[model samples]
Target chain A: MDLVVAVLFQLIYVIANLALISLGLAIIFGMMRVINLAHGEFLMLGGYTVVVATNAGVNIWIAMLILAPLVVGIVGVIVERLLIRWLYGRMVDTLLATWGLSLLMVGLVTSIFGASTATTVAPPLGAIRIGSYAASGYELFLILITIVLLIAVWLTLRYTKLGLLARGTMQNAEMASALGVSTSRIYMVTFGLGAAVSGLAGGLLAPMTGVLPTIGATYIAKAFITVISGGSAILAGTTAGSVLLGGLNGIFSFIAGSTFGEIALLLAAIVLLRLMPRGITGRFFRKSL
Target chain B: MNSGILRQMRPTFVYALLGIIFMFAAPQVLQLFTIINLTTAIALAVLALSLALIWGYGGILCFGQVAFFGLGAYAYTISAINFGGSTWAILMAVMITSAFAAALGYFIFFGRVSDVYLGVITLTVTLIFFSLIRRTSGPEYKIGNALLGGFNGVSSPPINLPWNPTSFLFPEQVFYVAMAALILCYVFAGWLVNTKFGRVCQAIRENELRAELLGYDTRLYKLGIFTIGAGIAAIGGVLFCNGVGRITPDVFNLYNAALTIIWVIVGGRGTLIGPIGATFALFYLTSALGGQSVLNNNLVLGIILIFFVLLVPKGVAPTIIDWVNARRKKAPGRVRRRRGSRGEGAQ
Candidate 1:
């Protein structure tokens, strides 16, 4: 009974973790249809922001919660303005360019920090005991935070003017422009917001995964699989996809090993994609945002 | 890929001539080490050529091309160890990789997966391979006494003479084999583009819906080119393993996959020789950077990608061709002829 509860808690945390890493990518891809291959780099940058800021003696919470997102958000805006703005609508070109950008980020970070970064930050919360086993209290906090983040995003998209404008622009740019919405500004803002979310997630995960110059490569394929498998709907799709994949991954990791877990996640994604080419939400939740 | 200038002479003839010349001349002038490196570069060029045909011409943006390349390498390595001969191992590698590609492509193309989704699926498949291979370090991962060395990887067998199995080929002989394969591949690709099948593939690339309406099986055509591309990439893998004298799981990495795309993009996608040229240029450029600590290779590559995408979007060969065409038009007779051509409906 104790094992079951602990397993369930870990599974939920795993799902939350997947959602946390993938939300930003889901939003960006869902809105722009421009698959940002540099999404992983953005996450990495956010992780660095926290690491760099904390090393300079800032509070770890503030660094993770605020500075990471802010720094990466600004970087996202700049990247959009400088590189992505010109490549809008050309999906393949955007992917390739961002891939290059990803490599550049890895190289730049490696040069600056060297390969092995001295990670001085640790998970800030104490462990919560589950029967004889103890689970990291930070994981519970992360799960709560992810829930809040999802709710916040949903509220913002459903009720906020900017969200409406952005969604409108995404759906039909010409129509939005005709209705006097500055579509380009929305694109920039949306991209920045997505980057900010990714940054926050990265900062959050850094304590658990640690930071490396080339760590983004590991996260990227997983994030891409989640986002693409989620299909078109942003919040609903990502949530659904992450839960399914992350749950399976957690269960398999517990049962077999991480390798098997990874293999399962990837295999499930491929089969899911083959079954529903447009993704789960693309087929099921055709009306959801 | 008909870079008008390259095609000015019979492309096959020109490729054959150049290939033959380089095959003989390179070993004489270049260092032994450089010749081996050139062989590796030639392997990559063939890989790029495969992409140029499928992505540039067939309009399939395969994000997992190296999947087949790695598969071929693995197949060749394992088979050579088990079969004890390079002759059958090479053939098996090509056949296995092509069959695997065909099977994978069948699911993707026939299932009507959209373009972007196709990229996701292929990439996923490739990552699966990478993940799967990285864990085979245990003795349990063996196929007929050939251990699938996990992270450290296995050393591929040397190519022995067909008649005398005791006499293995030197690096120079491997270089020769690589060059001959590349030239043959180039000539074959040049000839392919002019075929009826290739023409249909191009038409399908231009407008899939239109081609479908015209009663052509676009899926079959895509699968055909994809499978063929995989075969070419497999051969590249064989050459690559031969040149390096080893096979590792790293060949299935995202970096190599992206590098293949970069070569095609920078060298002019629609031109065969362009990517081959780009492969050699970038290959040497990276190697040169590797010898130094002053500059970062990835950063340089990133800047180049951005610069090309922003400015020279048509890539090197086509950009050069356009410039020459512009200059040629400045000649009095050419200018009059061009002007007369444009004079058709001025009013």
Candidate 2:
């Protein structure tokens, strides 16, 4: 019973973590058809921002609250204006270009910060215990904040004028332009928003994983896998993908080992993709995007 | 445009011949260490050439050629160390690695995934392979021979060449061997590009639907070409292990994979020789500019890549070639006639 509880707790953590990152990917892919290979690097950038600021004597929470999203948003704008904008339509170019961008980001980080792994401290408060079982307050805070953000995003997308404009631009860019919606601005803003979300996710997760130069290198692939498996179109799929990947990852890591767990996850995801080309949640959001 | 005039001064081909001559003579002129580094660059170039062939001509854009390269590296090390020393061991290793690549490529290409998605699949496979290799440190699993050293990689005793003239002349002998192999690969690839198989592959790249409509099996060609490329990459890996005198999991990491991709991109892709030239030039540049000694080498590399992607997308070699062609075609009458035709077409 204790073992089951431990597994369930870990599964929840994994799902929440995966969903936070995958949500950013889903928005980018759905809004721009350009699979941002550098998405993980953006997450790493956000994590690093908080780390750098805190090390410079800023309060960790305050640093994250102020600098994380802003840094990522600025990077998004620069990347879009300089690189991503040129690769708007050509999918392969976008893939290669973003790959180049990813390499540049990693190289720059390594050069600037050195390759040594950096760590961040969690909030000083201890775990919140209920009976014999205890959970980190930090983890709970992350879950709550993510939940709040998810709801806020859902409500905004479903009931806002900007959301309508975004939806219009996503569904048919030329048609939206013909109907007088400014899609170029929408594209820029959506890219920035996606980067901001990635930053926010990074800030929340940094306490657990800390700040390594290649921090998001591992998560980038996982995020892409989650996004594809969950169906790029559905918010629910991102959640589903996160839970599926995170839970399977945690359980398998516990059982088989980290390497084998990763292998098994990959093998399962590939097999699943072969069986369901549209993805598991792709069915529900087939035409939504 | 008589054949003789074109043949009399093909600067590109002449430059290539000059490069081959210089590489062959490098061992005699340079120190032992420099010669070894050149050989290493040659081996890396061979692998990069394979990437360009697949990505440039076939339009497959595989970001995971290093996985195949790693497979080859492991295969050669394991077979030679365990099965006893023989040249045949190396040959078998290359063949097996090629077969593995073929199987993976078959499933991937025939699955009807689009080219863009194929890059994702290949990249995923590479990362998964990296993770799997790292995980084999546990006692439960062993990678082939007992020497498969997990993250530390596998190294072996000096290879006992069947026709060894002298054991101490290893570096010189290896340089000669690498040059001969490179020439053979270049000639074979160049000839293949003009063959029916190559023509069909190019057509598939140019227009997949038209090729399919014409009843050509596109997947077969992609698989065949990918297999060939993988086999070549394996050959390069074997050469690499032989030159380095050791192999580590680090040899097959993301950075190495990124380097291979950058080599092809920085060199012209469609032409086989482009990446071959690029591998040498870039490696030499890195060595000369103190790539390893620099504090921020990765950042410098990143900046270089970004610059190339933004301003030199056709790669350095192809851009230079284009400039040469333009200069040679600077006849006023010919230029006027071309402009006249363009103006007519616009109207």
Which candidate leads in DockQ? Answer: 1
DockQ of 2: 0.48
Instruction: Look at candidate 1 and give me any clashing residue pairs.
Output: none
Give the CA lDDT, 0 to 100, for residue B142 in model 1.
Answer: 93
Task: Write one digit per residue (lDDT tens) for candidate 1, span B29-105.
Answer: 99998998998998898898888888877889898988988899899999998988898899999999999999888
DockQ of each: 0.61, 0.48
Q: Which prediction has the highest TM-score against the true structure?
A: 1
* Cα-lDDT of candidate 1: 0.86
Prediction 2 TM-score vs. true: 0.90
CA deviation > 4 Å runs, candidate 1:
B1-9, B334-347
lDDT tens string, model 1, A95-176? Answer: 8888889888888988788879647479999999999889999999999999999999999998999989988998899999
Candidate 2 lDDT tens digits, B154-232:
6744455753412423777788777766766665565555556776888898899999999999999999889988888
Interface Cα root-mean-square deviation for all models = 1.6, 2.1
TM of each candidate vs. truth: 0.94, 0.90
Error of 1 at B177 (Å): 0.4
Of candidate 2 chain B, the 10-residue stretch with the lowest lDDT total is B338-347
